[model samples]
Target chain A: MNDDDRTAMKKRVQRLVYMAAGGRISEADLGRYDTDLRQIGLDSLGYLNLLEGLERTFGVAIDLDHEEDHSFLHTIDNIVRYLVAQGGEAV
Target chain B: MNGDPTRGPIQDALTDCLGRHRGRRAVVGSEALSYDELGGRIHAAAGWLRGVWLEGGAGGRAPRHVGFCLGNRPEYVILYFAVLYAGDLPLLLDANFNTGEIESIRSDCGLDALVIEPAKAARLEAPGKGDQVPFADDVVLLPLSRPGAPPFEPRPATQVCRFTSGTTGRPKCLEFSGHAVVSAARNWVLGTGMTGEDRTLCLAALSNGLAFNTSLLSSFLAGGELHFLKGAPLTRPVARRIAESGITRLVAFPTLYRNFVAPGGPDRSAMAGLKHAISAGAPLWPDVREEFRARYGLDISDYYGIAETGPCTFEREADHHSGLGRPLPGAEIRIAPGPEDPDGPEETGEVLVRTASMASGYLNHPGLFEQRLDADGFYHSGDRGRLVDGRLHLVGRTQDHINVAGRKIDPTEIVAVVSALDGVADAVAFPDEDLNREALVHLVVVAASPELTRAAVAAACRSRLASYKVPGRISFVAEIPRTGIGKPRIAVLREQLNASAGA
Candidate 1:
C-alpha cells in the first residue's frame, strides 16, 4: 500500500481501537500509533471487542490460534500493516 | 475405593467417576487426558505435594491452604485435584487478581502455598514467599511461610474456598464443604441431562461459580468431556471448536452470546452440534437472545445462580425463553413479599434461596454470611425477583453493588480509590452502559482543580485496583448532588450528566 493509504489505515485502526476501548483508555492516550495498546489499559475484554470491531469494519477475521505471532495486534502500525497485507483498503 | 482411607466424599466420588470412565476422555485442552491418565496424574501430583509440604515441616499441621491462581486449563484441573487429594484445602482464586489482592488474601486467609504461573510467581512480592516447585510447563507451586495463625479459620467441614469481590481491595472468601461441592455437581449433572457422550466447551473461568458449578465436577460426574479454549473467547474460534469437537454444551457468559449474533459472526452450521448454550454470570439481554435464536435456531438458556448458592435454576424446555428457568434439583427458591407490596397474587420481592450446595460461610468476614440468612435457613439473595409460572424472573438488585460483565464490583471501592487522589473533591461510581450496551463502571468525579484530568484518575485506578475494578468511563463534574442523608442521588445525577453531555 501507498504511504498515504497506510497513514489512512492507521488512523482508521486508531479510531476503531478508541471505539472498542469503551472508555477504558482516553483518546488522548491512544494518539501514538507505536504505543502498546495493552500498556495503556486495553484489557482482555477490550481486545475481544477490538477483534469484533476489526471484523465488522474491515472484514478481517483474526483467528488467534492460527497466528503464531500476535505482534500484528500489538500496535496500530502493526494492525495497519496486517490489514493492508490482507487487502483491506481505506473506505 | 481408590485405596485411600482418608479420602473425603468429593475425592471418593471423583475416584469412582474416574474408575467408571477409565478409558474415556476427561479433559481436553492443548492436550487431552483420559480418565485413567488423569487419575494417575492427580495421584502423582498429590504425592509430590505431600512431599513438598512434609519437607516444609507442615505435615502434621491442619490442612494447608493451597491457593490456585491460574486460568482454566488441563493442568489447572489436575493441580486442583492434586491439592485436594493431598488433603489440603483448595482455594480457587481469580487469575486476574493483582499482586495487592493476592497479598490481601495471603494476609486475611493464610496461604501455605499457591499454584500460579511461573511469571507471576517471579513478580509476586509476598512476605512469606518461599521456594518454587515447577509442576507443569507453565504452572508452579510457590510455597509461602505462614508467619502466624490467620485471624479467622475455616470450619472443620470446609474443604474448598472461592472468593467474591469485596470493598477496599479485600475479597470475601466463601468456604464450601466437600459434600456441598459434590451435591452441586451431581445435581447439575442430573438437572441438565448431562450424559457420558456429552462434550462441554467451557468458556467461563473455572474459578467463577458459573463454570465451577456447571463444568468442573459436573462434567466428570456425568462422565463427559470438559474442554477449555486457550485464548480469548472470540466468535470464530469458539464456533470452530464447537463444530470441530462436536461440543454439545457451551457454558459461557452473555458477552460471548452477544458476539455470536453480531454482524460477521460465525454461521449457524458452526454451532450445529451445540445442544445447550448456557449463559450465566450476568443477565442475557432480550434482544441478543432473540437474535441468537433467530439466527442459530437454538435458545441460550439464561442460567440463574448465586455466588453463595450453587446451581439454582436451569431451563429444561427450549421453547420457554422467558425468565431464569426453574430451580435445579436439590435447590429451592422462595420469593418473600416486600413491605410495600400490594395484596396482589404475584408479588415481586427479594429472592431467597436454599440449596444443598450452599456455602458454609465466609472465612475472612465472620458472621457476615450468616447475617443474610433468615430463620428458615434461606439466604436472602439481594436480588429482587418474582416467581412467574414457577420460573424466577429477576427485576433488579436491591444492593448498590455494580455488576460489570458478571463480576460484582463494589462502587464504593472505586469511589474510595478516586477520592484518595489529589485534587479530587467528591466522586460517585455507578453501573453504566457503553455505546455497545456493555456494562461498565462509570466514575464521575468532581475535580477540585482544572488540572485534574480523566487520564489522571484512570491512571490512579489502574495502579491501585484490579483490572476489572478499574473504571471504564471517567468524567469530570463540577459537583456531585447528594441527598439530605448524604447518599448519592444516582438517578438525578444521571439526568444532569446526560443533559450536560447533550448540551
Candidate 2:
C-alpha cells in the first residue's frame, strides 16, 4: 500500500475505535497513537468489537485463530501497523 | 447399569465413549470430529500431559489446581478431559480476562499450573519457565508455573472448579465433585429429552453454565451432534447457521433472542428447523418471548440457576404456568424470610437451594461457602423468589451483583477496589439501564480532590478490574446516602447516579 492509502487505513481504524468506545474516545485521543485502549474505554470486549468492525470495513479476516490470541493486539498503533502489514488497504 | 446416567466420573465416561460410538458425530462446527477421533485426541493429550508431569525437574510434585486459559475450540474440550483424566482439577478461565484478573485468580486458588494459549501466557508474563506444546493446528499450550505459590489440597471429592463472584475481594473459585459434574449433564439431557438425532448449536462460551451443562457434555453423552456457530449470533448469521446445519436445539442467552425478534428480525422460514430454544442467566422480556413465539411458532423456555448451586429450576410447558417453572429433579429449593427484605418485594422470602450438582466449597477460603449456608445443608442463594402451588417465581436478588451482557459484576467487589485508591473517599457502584435498556455499571464517588476527573477514575479501574467490570459512567457525589445502620440507601444512591448522568 502507498503512504496515502496507509494513512487512510489508519484513520479508518481510529474511527472504528471511536465507535467501539461509544464516543467516549475521540480523534484527539488518537494523537498519542500508542495510548493503551484499555485505559480509555475500549476494553477487552470493546477491542473485540473493534476487530469485528475492522474486519467488516477492510474486507479482511483480521480475527485471531482463538479469542485468546487477541491478547497481543491491544494498543491503537499496534493494530494499525499490524493491519497495514497484513495487506489491509483503504478504498 | 453401566450408563446409569446419574453416577460416574466424567473422565470414566470419556473412557467408556472411546471408539464405541464411531461414525457418530461428536463435534460439527469448524471441523467434524466423530467420537472415535475426539476420543483418540483426548487420550493423546492426556498421555502427553502425564509424560510432562512425571518427568524429572525442579519441584517434581504435581499440580492439584490447574487452570485452562482456553477458548471456544474443540481442543479445549480435549484438554478438559485430558486434565480430569489425570486426576487433576481443571479451572476454566475466560480468555477475555485481563492480566490483573488472571494474577488475582492465580493467587486466590494457589494454582500450581495453567495451560494457556501462547499469546495469553505471554501477556500474563506469568512466573516460572514457559514451554510451548501443540494443542491443535492453530492453538499451542503454555504451561505456567506458579513457583512460589502455596500448595493447595481441594476438599474431598472435588472434581471441577470455576470462579464466581465473592462477597468481597477477588472472585472465589467454586468446586464441584465428580458425581456432581456428571449428574449435572446427565440430568439436563434426561430432563430436556435430548436424543441422538438432536443437533445442538452451542452459542455461549464453554466457561459459562448455560453452555457447559446444557449444551457441552449433555449433547455428547446423549450421542448428539454438537455444532458451534462460526459467526456472530445476530439475525442473519444465526439464520444462515440454522439453515445450513439444521440446528435442532439452540442454547443461547437472552440478548440473542432480543436481537432475533427485534425490528429487522430473521426471516420466519429460516428458523424452521429449531425444535426448542432455551435461555439462561437473567429473564427474557415478555415482548421478546412473545414476538419469537409469534414469528417462529416456539416458546423461549427459560432456565434458572445459581453459580454456587447448579440447575435449580427448568421451565416446563405444564399447566400454562410461566414463572421460572419447576425445580429440576434432585434439587431441593427452600423459601425463607429474607434477612433484610427488599422494598415492595414480590416474594416475602429468600431462596435456599441444595442440589446433587452443587459445588463442594470455595477452593481458596474454607468455611466461606458454609457461611452462606445455614444450619441446613442448603446454600442461601442471594436471590429472592417465592414458591406457590409448586412453582417458583423470582422477584430479585438481595445482593448487588449486576448482569451486563451475560457477565456478573459484583458492586461490592468494585467498591472495595475503587475505595482503596488514594484520592477516592468512599465509592459506591450500582447497575442502571442504559439507553438500549441493557445493564451498565455506574460508579458514584466522593473524590478527595476535583482534579480526579472521570478519565482518572477510568484509568484506575482499567488497571485493577476486568474490562467488563469497569464502570461505564463515573460521577462525583458529595456523600453516600446511608440508613441508620450505616448501610448505603440503594434507592437514594440510584437516584443520585441517575441525576448525575442526567446533568
Candidate 3:
C-alpha cells in the first residue's frame, strides 16, 4: 500500500475503533487503544459497521467474496496485509 | 375494484387522521410521532409513491412484489403503505436474516425493487449494486407524505411471500395475498374490539407476524396508533412508551410477555392505561396467561395462525374462551374427517383451514406450493388440533407427535408437563428415533436457581402424564435455543441429542 493508502487505512481503522466502542471508550484513549481487535470492543455488528464505514470513507467497493475469505478479516493487520496484496485491485 | 371494498379497506383508517381521535403513542425510538404525524406520513408516502410510478421512473410493469428489507424506522412505515398504494405486494424481510439469506430471497422472489433503511443499507453486502429503491433518511418527512394520490388497482390475486420458519428442515416461502391482508386485519380488529380510541404497543420486530400484520396493519386498519419498542430489555421501556403514548392495547408473543412477567414485573404506572393484551406465535401456558391477566387486569387474548395463513383465529372479546376461537369472517375451518378420530369432538382430526387471508403458496417453489394447498384449497396446517364446543384447541405439531406402542402422543403435552416443574424455565420434547421404538426425548432448560436433575424432570413428567407418554430420556440445558418468535428449535435440540448419542 502507498503512503496515502496506508494513512487512509490507519485513519479508517481509528474511526472504526471509535465508532465500534459507541462511547464506551473515549477519543483521548485512541493512543492507548488496543489494536488487538477484540479489546477495541468491536462486536460482530460493530465489525460489520466498521467494514461499511471503511467502504464509505475510501469510496471503494469491497468485493464481499474476498473480505469474507477468512485469510482476511481475522485482525486489522490481516486486513491491511490483504489490502497491500490486492494493490488497489477493486476490493 | 377501485370502489367500496377496495377503498373502504383503508379509507376509515385514514379517517382517524382527523384530530377527533384520542392521542396514544405507538412507536418509541428517536421520537414518538403522534397519530396525526403518523397518519400524515402514511398519506404523504402513498402520494409520493404514486408520483414516482406516474411521473418518475418506477414505471408500470404489472406491479410486482416489492421487497422491504428495512428495520424499525418511521420510513419503513411510510414505505409499507406506499407499496400498498402502488398496488404492489410488500414482501417483508426480517432485519436479522444474514446477507446470504437476504440475497437468496431477493433473487428467489424476483422482487421488482427493494426499499432499505438508509442506515442499514450500507451494511448490506452490496447496497447500491442491487435493484434498490433508495429513499432518503427523511423519507417519512411531512410534505413528502400526502394521501390524495391517484388510485391504482391491485391485482385481485396478488400475494406477499415470506420464508416459513424451517424447523422441519428446509425453509419454504409462504405467500399471503392482498385479500388475506385485509381479511386478517379486519379479523384482528373485530376479535380485539379495537377502536380509534385504542392505541397499540408493538414490542416485537416489524418483521414478525405479531408486530407485522397484527400490530402494524391491524392498527392502521382499526385507526389505532402502533407504538414500536426500540430495543431489547423490552418490558420496562415498552410499558413506559405505552403509558406515555396512551397505548390501550398491547400485542405480543408468549415469550415476550413471559419476559415482562418474569421477576420484577413491568412498572405498574407504565402499563396503567393498557386495556387489551394479546399473545400468539407460541402457546402461552395457562398459569402464565392467568398471571399476566391478574397482573395487568387485561386478558391475554390467545391468537392462532401460521405464516402460511395470516391472523386466522383469535379469542372473542365477549367470552374469553380457552380454545383458539372460531374462524374469522371469510375463513373456513375443517377438522379433517379422516379414518382416525381422536377422543375429543366428533370430527376433530387435523385442523385444516381455507381462508381468504391464506397465502397463495411458497415463492418460486411451485412443488411446495402445490403440496401445502391441496386440491380442495384447504391448507393442511400440519398442526394437530381438535374442534371442541365449536372452538379449535391446538394439540401440537403433527410432525412432532410420537407413535409409541400403537398410541399417538403429542410432545406438547409432555413439554407442558415438563415446563410446569420447579426450576424449569423452558422445555422441548421430541421423539428420539436413534433410540429404540421411537422414545420421546425431553430437553429442559432450568432457570438460574436450585439445580434441576434429569431424574427430577422424569419424575415430574411421570406424575403428570402416562408412563408411555413420559420422556424416555432427559437432558438438561442452560437455555433452549429459540426462534426470534420464541418457539423452541426442536430440530436443533434433536441434532444436539444425536451428536451426544454418537459421542
Give chain A TM for each model in order.
0.91, 0.75, 0.57
In candidate 1, stretches whose alpha carbon ends up further than 4 angstroms from where it belongs are A23-26, A55-72, A82-91, B1-6, B55-59, B340-346
Strongest candidate by TM-score: 1
Q: For model 2, what is the C-alpha lDDT against the true structure?
A: 0.73
Clashing pairs in 1: none
lDDT of 2 at B146: 66
Best-to-worst order by DockQ is: 1, 2, 3
Each prediction's whole-model lDDT (CA): 0.88, 0.73, 0.59
C-alpha RMSD in Å of predicted model 2 compared with the true structure: 5.1
Error of 3 at B153 (Å): 18
Residue-level lDDT of model 1, residues A1-91, one tens digit each, is 6788778778888988987877667678888999989778787888998988787778776778778789899999889888878877543
lDDT of 2 by residue, B301-371 (tens): 88787777778777767334377777787788889886587564555688899887888888877888889
Please give each candidate's TM-score: 0.95, 0.84, 0.60
Cα error, candidate 1, residue B418 (Å): 1.6
Q: Which 10-residue window in model 1 chain B sums to the lowest lDDT?
A: B1-10
TM-score of 3: 0.60
Checking candidate 2 for backbone clashes, the offending pairs are: none
lDDT digits (tens) for residues B1-503 of candidate 1: 12332377788889999999999999999989999999999988888888886644224557889999998899998988887888788999999999889888888999999999898999988887898999888799999988888888898788789999999999999999889999999999999899999999999999999999999999999999999998778888899899999999999988889889987788999899989999998888899999999999999988789999998999999999789899999999999887754653467888999999999999999999999999999999989889988999998887889898889999998888899999999999999987767789989999888889877788799889999988888877788899999998999899998999899
